[model samples]
Each structure stands twice: as C-alpha cells, then as structure tokens.
Target: MVDDTSLTSLPKCCLSVVIPCFNEVERIQQCIDRVLEQPVVGEV
Candidate 1:
C-alpha cells in the first residue's frame, strides 16, 4: 500500500468539481455557492 507521508508532500493542483444534477434548479444555486466559498475551489 502507498504511504500517507508521500501524499502529504505532493504539490497542489487545480481542482475541478462536477455536480451532475437533474431537476435541481431550486437548490443548484445554493450548492454552487457553498462550493465557491471553499478556498481551494477555483470554479464550480
């Protein structure tokens, strides 16, 4: 198995979050807004 120490030293990279939704218009905005609030999230 891989060691956890090695993973911690890895360089940071851009993150992409994909939210596939159907008939979620009412709460989609809220979900996107919460994701955007995260410091590591560049886009939603």
Candidate 2:
C-alpha cells in the first residue's frame, strides 16, 4: 500500500469533462459555456 506522505507530494493534473448530446441543440450552448467558465489547469 502507498504511504500518506507520498500521496501529499504527488502532482496535480487537469480535468476533462465529456458530454453526450443526442438532440440538445438548445442546451448544448449553455453546457459548453459553463464548462469554459472554469479554469483549465491540465493539457488539452
């Protein structure tokens, strides 16, 4: 098992959110807009 000290020293990574839209033409814009509002810390 890993130790607590090692976990704390580990580096942080970015997040990637994937959405599935079948026929969300109206709500698709809003969904993408909300996600862009957040800060992207990881690679794209």
Candidate 3:
C-alpha cells in the first residue's frame, strides 16, 4: 500500500494518460480534453 501524502507530494503534470480507441473520431477529442484537464496529466 502507498501513502496518500506521497502521491499528493508529486509535482504537477507528472502523469501520462494513455487511451486506446479504435474508430473513435467523434469521442476521441472529448476523451483527450477530459484527460488533459487533470492537474497531474502531463501528456495524453
């Protein structure tokens, strides 16, 4: 188990989100936008 404080202490934009979608032209942008909105999301 990991401590919550350890997770929160990390710098911003330290996380990268990966989304695998096939034939998702319409929803891909929306998904990417949401993922990028996160403070911890460095890249999508």
Whole-model lDDT, candidate 3? 0.78
Model 3 residue 20 CA deviation (Å) reads: 1.4
**Cα RMSD of predicted structure 3:** 4.6
Candidate 3 stretches with Cα past 4 Å from truth are 1-14
lDDT of 3 by residue, 1-44 (tens): 98998998877555556688899998999998988787767554
10 residues in a row with least lDDT, candidate 2: 35-44
Model 1 score (lDDT): 0.86
Name the lDDT of candidate 2: 0.78
TM-score leader: 1
In terms of TM-score, how similar is model 2 to the real structure? Answer: 0.58
TM-score of each: 0.60, 0.58, 0.56
Query: For model 2, what is the alpha-carbon lDDT of residue 7?
Result: 98
The residue-by-residue lDDT of candidate 2 on 4-31, one tens digit each, is 9999898876587987879999898998
User: In model 1, where do residues sit more than 4 Å from their true spots?
Assistant: 1-11
lDDT of 2 at 9: 98
Rank all candidate structures by their lDDT, best first, as comma-separated numbers: 1, 3, 2
